[model samples]
Target: MEPKHKRRVRYKGTHPKKYNEKYKELNPELYPETIEKVIKKGSTPVGMHLSIMVDEILEFLNIQEGQIGLDCTLGYGGHTLKMLECLNHTGHMYALDIDPIESVKTKERLLNKGYGEDILTIKNCNFKDIDLVSNEAGLFDFVLADLGVSSMQIDNPERGFSYKKEGPLDLRLNPQKGIPAFIKLQELNKNQLEQLFIENSDEPYAKEIAKNIDSYLKSGQLISTTTQLYKIIEKSLSFIPIKERKES
Candidate 1:
């Protein structure tokens, strides 16, 4: 049998210039393309305010270039914009929200900020569907799940998330996706209400709150506004602590 020729081992010096050039081709944003344009032109939505803990969030995540991230709850895109500043042009940021309205707002903001090219992908979907979205986009380097309603949604009276406002009791972040808060209250029994309060708010007076809800339902006193609910909750519980009272 003829002896097999030795396979040539490729060393850094032995490699062709094309082989070294491939690295630059793979990461043009880092090597050749200017990332300053992307960072310098970063924009925030009108009236956008970041959370107090944004710096802490960034520190914990330790965002780096060429890293993909997901803002699971793209409230006003404050965190999203910050992450965009940290990411390379090659890095992708996926901002997901169930509300079509917010999605539209975010899209407009991103377009104005010059992220319309491909750095960001906005999806109108729930957090549960993020895995599917990420799977399609490959895994993310960082994933931010800012659960619950955003300050903007809560501050906006039309959304009906604030007890201070007397808007329609429509607390479904995405009004088209789930039943409104009023409808949900109408459907829920006392036990269900208690369970929801306990699970979500961790209120100790959940049972009492549920009893009050039952009483209101039985008396035909349909409470269809956040203000009405707030009054009911306030009246039901008297000695709640400040922290607990705020939640109530």
Candidate 2:
């Protein structure tokens, strides 16, 4: 055997375990379980109520570090935050929403978390006109356009997206942008009503619905609320059972 190796000494630094023990000893009020959870969780995570097929989105986009991502409908910033997590420090997110109130809330929350110019760009504008928005941030490597409404609009009673909710007849994604639902109802002609039924609700008796709506307006009982419109539809087609009617 070669010369016997001399015994080597290993030195260990003062460990986190020792520091934690000392900290607990000094602060008896601290709950160990809570502290452990905090250490594990790091910071509070943001929540979202979108039907974003995240897996599909990522698969199509092929997100990578330092890539730029645009969330056309950044409802509550769910996709934005998720993309940020995957992006490198140099990467950025441009989140857009038509709703001013919702946009403001999302901006404040993102800014509060130390995400500044390097991390995020929030815009309160419609996604349909992509040129106006893209001019600010230029072309993005990944663009996520989640078409249609979000759960928050439906859940929030004030937004009036839900028929069950007793609120104003305002179904606009951006209250300031589009005609209010009630006002839109007033503007619909028989042909327009028939078209709306076919496109949006896919009503089986689209022609019948349009005729009934015209008749109801003629009676001076124009629908102004979801409840009112629902009642009109029910009464107009009372001859048919609701269950047997074609689904939208």
Candidate 3:
């Protein structure tokens, strides 16, 4: 007998609050209509990254056929794909990203689209080490570096980049390299936490937030998830009105 076919995952309501639960948005190719609808509503689909300022970037670079191009940050390969198109499959493009997981997935995705070894090369390396890449590939005719946290990184709950969803408190760009945020949080003292809040994000209620987090730790409660930390922040600023606190 043939193996049983599983039904598609069903969400409780019209909207999916969890990032992983967004099955349609995750698979954009298989559900173009849903993707289009999400885009039309001025929201990017989960697990899909729309290249920003595509025309503006192309205009500035003025990439030509048979020219070498370097993409310093290949998040979802959207910009890389466009740059490859500008090369018209004649020249080669080299892309680098710190995210080993996403970069490998993107390499396979581009290969499927016919951008093989001859046309595209992707490496799981930081842009800070561009000299290494340049040493191998030589000088680039044009370079594109769209810097910022990728939406894929921010939106994925498992990546732990955002507090909007509950997930493991791991926030490293390369999850393999460093200790997780949860570990880091446990290590820092109250004063260090306050300084970190101010120095890192310019948070005004740094002292209060840090104090509360310290309190939880002193009580032997480990803050393990994004939501757990988010609640601690909320409680710290509970005195602020709803409107102002919401912005925080």
| Candidate whose lDDT is highest | 3
The residue-by-residue lDDT of candidate 1 on 15-51, one tens digit each, is 3343223342223233422334333566322123344
Query: Using TM-score as the measure, what is the rank order of every candidate, best first?
Result: 3, 1, 2
**Per-residue C-alpha lDDT of model 2 across residues 158-244, encoded as one tens digit per residue:** 677766746677888888786888778778889999999899888778888788888888787756677777777777688787676
Clash pairs for candidate 2: none
lDDT of 3 by residue, 1-248 (tens): 99999987788989876766777656665788888898999998878788899999999999999999999999889999988988998989999999998888788888888899889988889999999999999999999888877887887889888887788989889998989999999999999999999999999999999999999998999998999999998899999999976675
Candidate models: Cα lDDT each = 0.75, 0.71, 0.89
TM-score of 3: 0.89
Q: Model 2: residues >4 Å from true position, as ranges?
A: 1-51, 246-248
Listed in order, each prediction's TM-score against the native is 0.72, 0.72, 0.89
Candidate 3 regions with alpha-carbon error over 4 angstroms: 1-22
Cα lDDT for residue 162, model 3? 87
Q: Is candidate 1 or candidate 2 better by lDDT?
A: 1
What clash pairs does model 3 have? none
